[model samples]
Target chain A: MKRTFPLIIAAVAGYVMVVAYFMPALQQVREDAEEWFNILAAIAMILGGASILGMHLRKVSDRRAGWGFSVVTLLGFLVTLYVGLFKVGVPPMPEYPDRAWTGEYIAQGSALWWSFEYIIYPITATMFALLAFYVASAAFRAFRAKNLEAMLLLGTAFVILLGRSYAGTLLTGWYAEEYPNLTLPGLTDMIMGVFNTAGQRAVMIGIALGIAATSLKILLGIDRSYLGSRNG
Target chain B: MKTETIILNSFLGLGVIALALWMIAWGQEGKFLGAQYVEVRDTIEVYDSRELAWFRTPDPDDPEETIGYWVERAALPDSEPPELADPEAGDVVVEPADLDRFTPARTWEIQRGVSRDRADEDGVVLSLSRTIGLWFAAICTLFVFSFLYRDNPFYKFAEALVVGVSAAYSMVVAYWTMVIPNLIGKLLPDLVQAAFVPEHDQPFYAPHIGVLILSILLLWRLSPVGGWVARWPLAFIIGTTAGFRLIAHLESDFAIQIQATILPLVVRDDGGFNFWMSVRHLVIMLGVMAGLTYFFFSIEHKGFVGKTARVGIWVLMITFGAGFAYTVMGRITLLTNRIEYLFDDWLWLIS
Candidate 1:
């Protein structure tokens, strides 16, 4: 019953959505479905929070490696949730001067606001900044010219590294002045705008066709693997 | 650690400390070892002579009462107030003072945003609080950046704090912005209306009923013996996404991409092939065919097909390498921004 019911739902939902896209009268159905999605998505976000907390709690309870970090995570999560939901440090809005706790949770000077501006923004920025260092190290480890393909990769990497920076400009600036086409930047741009775009386009076309076929399969109940084996 | 590694680490540490000290010195008097942004006065290319840069001119949308309106640095240093400043014959020399300019005219040496009143420095309310806040921010920023050296307690704490706070902030924003306003407020229209907030008149639509039933069905999965009930919601979600993605991808990723590849080999603007453009066009055409061929597993890659695939591999590598470099450049930009914030905003080191 579970298998058959979901398949029926899948077919109905899939066909309804496809039809909604094509037919003019059923346009509102798409919008309504999106609204339905939003409500479900909000609940899903809450579910995510629950899942993260649950995982961390279990880890802490188990006394696993990095369990102390898990404790920190839980403490951080709880404190933030408390401050945000309770509007701990929020002052009343100017319009409603006399009203207590009737202010935006993110009002300036509030604890949550302070935490966001000071604690959250900086850490996030720094975390993301690690990617620059990580990528550089990754390139060093990965780029070994062992074969013709590897050599080509390395050559391209060198062109890109130089061309995108002041070093490339310095090296090829004279050539650029005499012949714009011969310049490294010019070569890089041409390579990217033309060759890259073409390759990307081909890949995307293949992916799109694959998605359409998969969608068809699911709609026809030919891909019941998502639910489980039919025997189960 | 090896001596060489220790030496490098020491130098990095020294550089950071030196930079910090220089910032403190600059903040005190706006001159740290005579270092400043070499004021480059030049005209930048203008698109639409009337259009304004961000925070440059008064916003047309907002009323005059809004702050940051009258401030602009469009006028050249030598020129008298440029009314219809010709973009072709104008130079801008913007400095820190320019941004803090509150007056309609310069020669008014008054710093606008900055409170120059010496007495206010001692004022416990705004000054003390702001000072504490800036220090707190700087300390947190340092804690996060400590991860660059090695993961420690400070870094872990900072990471946890950021993750937790951001997650909560997002949830709070969603609840207030979406769920409460759309669902609860709409459903309890009269009560919400009485609370001086707008609510939809027609909330009990077919979609609403459908969503409720489905939501109930979804929640039913949470029950001990009813886990299978969740399959319906999962299937619905997957089906809808598949349908949506199919059409969206087909239109955008396939049709548009295919259409885009149909390009002219000649550079028409310069009235000829322009020498290298023809070569570029040829390379692109070949690359596309070869790349598609490489992905085509139906034919066994041998002889002619294998050669084409090899060329395609080169194209793919070039594409990936260029993409990686671009991403690296972007990440470096963000890192540069944080460094700038540390100096200019946090430490008050440089202008």
Candidate 2:
């Protein structure tokens, strides 16, 4: 039931949504189904939260090691939750001046808002920015021009990287004024416009086709490995 | 305690579920009534009715006529059963507006269009051209895919062609979206208008150009003599972007998300009761912190901190597994969708 039920639901809903696109009558039905799915996903978040808390509470009680960290985590979690949910120091909503709890939890200038603005934003950005360092390292390792094909790939990459910026234009800016056709930037632009787009479209089409074939296998009751070992 | 917890939470969970179902029903009420429709109606006072007479005299029995006709909210009827409608009928009986809903992009029409506005052009010309292009690209793909098959000249040609095409397309989009709109729109008018008013003529080069200049400086690292020139712009971008993003990321990710976890056991007047949700958040926050502690690679996790960190790893692993499972399901769904399209929409090889 676990395996078959999910597959049947997926197949039915998937097909319905697709048909809904080409039919006006089914539009609302399709949108409603999508919204319901989202709401269910949201509710699942509560379950996830409970599971996390339960697991940690067990570990802290057992004192397996580094129990201090669990204490800190639990404390931090509770404090943040309390601050946010209680709307700590958040002024009442202007519409409900008499009500103490009418204000939005993340109201501007509120403590929760301050915490978000100051504490959370920087950490995520720093993590994202770390990708640059990773990219640099990866490029150094992966971008070896061992063959003619590799050489061509390398050349194209260089042209695109340069063309995207002022460097390509500066080197060939004189060409823009003198002979626009022959300019490095213009040539680079043409290569990207004509070549890269065509290639991307083709790959996308193949991937789409492959995805279709894969999906058909699943829907037709042929490939059901995703459900794990036991069908029931 | 466990039984009591389950009993107490069961009712709460049921309440939440009921609320969710009601919200969904309310949101999609229009669909249920079969009254949600998009229709475009315009009365054209044609100088000669013969010019567009075909639309006016469209066959009443034709399904296409009803396609665009909207069923008004007040007049909406119950959905006729599929069995009554004869689901076995292969033909699509959609209301007309659905067919004309999606308009292809201007550039796409231009690029893929047959012979740039030929009056006597065959309808299949664009399709044929696309087919030919696809075949050539597919062959090139096979060659590119041949890298897996053991690299050869055919693959090389495809790879090079792909690179060339990609570069060209990016330039086209950049020109339309960024260069012409941002640069020319700002510079040309002000320059022309400046002839009359010198103060108004001040050319405002967008800060984007400055950023672009800095980006160019990054390329200087490739050359020996002028590589030093790249550092100034690099430093500016790094410093400014870091300064700008530092606070924004922290607020949204850490503070607000963490704040969201707190549960209020008692609802102060007018604060809608969210006791369960707050507790849930607190738990999630604990999980996140534990997970982070697990990744503290620099510190040895031997004693108190170490064991707790280990628990954190388990949390992370479970989270990862869940995320992976979710993604797999999504991919499967996408795959299913495409197959349905092929079978039902484009190719009617299968029922």
Predicted model with the maximum TM-score = 1
Our tally of clashes for model 1 stands at: 1
Clashing pairs in 1: B23-B349
lDDT of 2 at A134: 47
Off by over 4 Å in 2: A1-3, A58-76, A99-105, A181-184, A223-232, B1-351
In the range B44-77, model 1's lDDT, one tens digit per residue, is 2222212222223222354342222122345434
Candidate 2, residues B1-351, lDDT tens digits: the string is 599668756976896686466546744742211111111121211112111111111234663432112221222234421211223342433322232333312110112232222413443222332333323332333343334434455544443333323232233333333333344434464642322222233355453354345445544545556555544433333222222233334445444544544434344446676664455444454555565566566789889778767656544444433333334334444444434433332222344
Give one digit per residue, the lDDT tens place, for model 1 in A1-232: 7798899988887888888999989998877766766766665566567767888899999999878888877887778778876777665433332233456667655667767876777778877887889888988997899987787667776787788888888989987878886688877876678767877877887898899999999999998877965533
Q: After superposing candidate 1, which stretches have Cα over 4 Å from the reference?
A: A61-65, A85-111, A224-232, B1-137, B190-206, B219-225, B265-279
Each model's lDDT: 0.67, 0.43
Kindly report, for each predicted structure in the order presented, the TM-score of its chain A compared with the true chain A. Answer: 0.83, 0.78
